[model samples]
Target: MSTLQVRVARKVSEADGISSFELVAADGAQLPAFEAGAHIDVHLRDGLLRQYSLCNPPQERHRYLIAVLRDPSSRGGSTAMHDEIEAGHLITISAPKNHFPLEPAARSLLFAGGIGVTPILAMAEALAGAGADFEMHYSARTPERAAFLQRIAAAPYAACVHVHYDSGDAAQKLDCAAVLGAPRADTHIYVCGPGGYIDHVLGAAKALGWPAAQVHREYFSAAPVDEAGDTAFDVKLASSGQVFTIPPGRTVVEVLAEHGIDIPVSCEQGVCGTCLTRVTGGVPDHRDVYLTDEERAANDQFTPCCSRSKSAVLSLDL
Candidate 1:
């Protein structure tokens, strides 16, 4: 994939444990244009790559703004960004890619949890700019932990945005059922955040008879999988007709690389969909949050970084 060298123009502490970075073209030229709900893959030291959503308005081409929350359980990306990277530092990042895109709707409803507000914030900017009808609900653990409170308050569409806190009074809390109400064909819902929070919002919509097509979501991290029942499986490469056994605890990507086969991968958690490969035959266990239920049911493709096989022998179009 092509990449752009950018300079960290500035970095500011947005909240208690969150920091926002403004990246400009290294040569002071215009950067590529991006849309709301898009993210860039930041290439870090030691081959660590992390995807962060663009929070700034999409119309701006001068810089890309991304926020990172210092995750205590980070696999290295968030910790390095918080500790090693500094202002004016040069870095390489991929162009913006949007797997979670905004669709045309009569009325839009957006729910953001913690740092998940990154993409939802951008969507708000776009929706407000277009003069579209929309409502945004932001949830955080506390007032001190919420990022971009001032920015959102200062926005022209501030009246449409609502803030909720876990520590706040129950009367001010979010009532998902009341907000979601009866599903309308012309209304769409978008959610991004922690797995449990996403589940709550989606579950409310589901119970309200919302069509799956009207609801969209993006997961920052997948829920932990129980691998105790995982068993060994075999995979065959289409090009070489080579068959290899994948042990219970080992991943397909790791085993294949040992034999000189390499597949581009990022967010080995299976959230990025970078190592998604075509499956010629056999069923996959489907251990990823990237694909929708319909896509998983098709069984035509699978993410090798974390997903495993269900059949005894699987075939990959490598």
Candidate 2:
């Protein structure tokens, strides 16, 4: 885990209920270099660790740019990033990390839903630089709500970029089949958006017989956490040989942290893999979106935040 440091955040632009924040280390240290489609966990003033994608080109190493939409039902992160963070105010953040990487492919298709455009915007910049054949599909509720419209409009494949507005009868729903139809040999598809959008695109791609390797996705929503019950269970920490009872209403992470154990965590909702720990013995109710079937089958990794133990006694590598 990278150390979180206070960085000065500068307001760059604002429009359509979204704001762009530029963060640079207060001491003038060079910010960690990151690829397009990479993101960092920003610790807001309200103590929310929210992930924001890097929208600026990597060549601009002076600072990292993040565009955040003030979600109406935000759990606190986006609203904080957009409304509370101001220019020159210091904010804590993690170094950039990328799970939504641009894989090697002859061509690629990028789809963005509303605020999900952050990461895909970076990918577009990277693809444009590499002279790779690509297209961008941006779907927003309306043109006014769309951020980075000017930049994406001027892209080399600008003509290929589709904008769908859901204002009225002309609502542009993402044509998953049509988008998938554009797949060429050795072509890759990247999708990011709300949970429904991601699920729709992924399901449509699979239904089209696209190989799993050819489809990539990133989730922005976190799974809802459940309360613990009165029935407590024992969790043996393999590293410390200590045991703690996980109260029915508490999560594995909560109990471990209470016992002075810190398993790296970013999004406590299980969307991020930062809180993942090895499960030495237990039937884990894997609720995280980060792991694949193979990883879960190995029973070696578990997200203590959202995942629960089916076994009466669970052992963790910690």
Candidate 3:
């Protein structure tokens, strides 16, 4: 993958545990243009790669802004960004890639939870710039934990944005049912946040008879799955007729790598669709949060990073 060397021009504490990093080209040249909802992969120490959404306006090319929440359970990515990286430090990152681009609609509704506001903030900026009709509801545990409160308040579309705090009064809280209301064909809903929060928003939409296509979501992390009953499985390569046995508690990617077969992967949790591979035969367990319901039902492609096979023998196109 092509990468860009960038200098950390500045780093500021955005909220309680969130820090925003401003990255500029190392050579002081214009960076690649990115659309809203785009994210860049930050390559960190120990070969750790993490994706962070760009929060700044999409029209700007001078710098890229990304916010990172110091996760206590981080597998070294967020911790390194918070401790090792500093202003004036040089870092390598991939160019922006957007899997959550905003779709056109007559009216848009956006819901953001905690740090999930990163992408939604960019979407608001893009929508505001286009003079499109949109409304945003931001939910946080508390005001102090919310990132970009000042930025959102200062935006030209400030009136269209609503802030909700879990610690605040019950009446002021985010009522998903009330906000979502009846589904309209011309109105689209976008949501991003923790798994439970995303489920709440999506569940409400589903109950309201909202079409799946009109409701979009991006998950920051997937819910933990119970693997106590997981069993061993075999994967067959269609190209070379090679078969590899994936043992219990072992991932397909790890086993494949031992056999000199490499699959590009990021966010090994299956949040990023980097290692998605075509399945020639057999049913996939489908543990990834990246694929939609329809995509998972197709069973033609699967993320080998974390997903496993339901059948005893699964065939891969590669």
Candidate 4:
């Protein structure tokens, strides 16, 4: 993907441990238009690239707003943005891309967990502008932990917004059963958050008989990968006829990258399908959540960023 240089225009503390960065074109030109639920890959110092959802309204083309959370266990992306990056600093970024875009439906329901509210906030704004029937439910560990609460409360769809907190009163907490207990025809639900929260909402919807196709979700992180079960394997490149030993503790992408084979990757967590490569032979462990059940069963492709080989050897159509 091509990269664009942009300048950090401003920074604002949205909540505890959460800050929103406003980026604008360094040359003061219009940026590519993007819809709700879009995200950009922010290229940080030291070859670190991170994806952040655009929280600003889609109608605004001059600036892109992204909120970042300072993760204690971060591998440097979030922490660097919080500590090193400052206003007026120029950074390279990929154009906006969306995997959790809002779908057209008669009625829509948005569920956000903590920092997941970023994209949903933009969706709420668009829905309100279109005079569509929609409502948003945001949940956080505490009221202070929720980012963009003030902006959401001031939106035109403020009346349709509901806030829930784990520390708040039980009576006002989120009632998954009440909201998703029954499925509505022509209605689609969009959810973006941590794996646990997404799973909880999706699980409740399924148990309530909601069609799987009607439920949509985006996971910020993949499920924990257990290295204990991992075993060393071999991956042979089809063109070069070269084989790379993928040790138990290493991933296919990491091993191949060290050998100067640069495979495009966005989310190393295996949630994004950017690094999916065709599999000519052998079985893939299929640890990713991006592929569907049918796709996994087909065994024609796999995400090398996180997946492993089930067999001792695997062949890639590189």
Model 2 TM-score, 2 decimals: 0.90
Q: Which candidate is the best by TM-score?
A: 3
lDDT of all predictions, in order shown?
A: 0.96, 0.81, 0.95, 0.89
The collision pairs in model 3 are: none
Q: Compared to the true structure, candidate 4 yields what TM-score?
A: 0.95
Query: In the order shown, what is each candidate's alpha-carbon RMSD?
Result: 0.8, 2.6, 0.6, 1.6
RMSD of 4: 1.6
- Identify the runs in model 4 with alpha carbons over 4 angstroms from their true place: none
The most accurate candidate by lDDT is 1
What is the Cα-based TM-score of model 1? 0.98
**Model 3, global lDDT:** 0.95
lDDT of 3 by residue, 39-66 (tens): 9999999899999999999999999999
**Residue lDDT tens for model 2, 1-318:** 565565656675555888888788888878878998899988776567888899988767778889888888888887777677778787778888998899999989899988889999889888888888888888887778888888777767677688877673533766778878844668999998888888888888888888877888888875454544436678898878888888777788888888788777788777778888888887787878888667888878888887877778789986
Global CA lDDT computed for model 1: 0.96
In model 3, the runs with Cα more than 4 Å from the true position are none
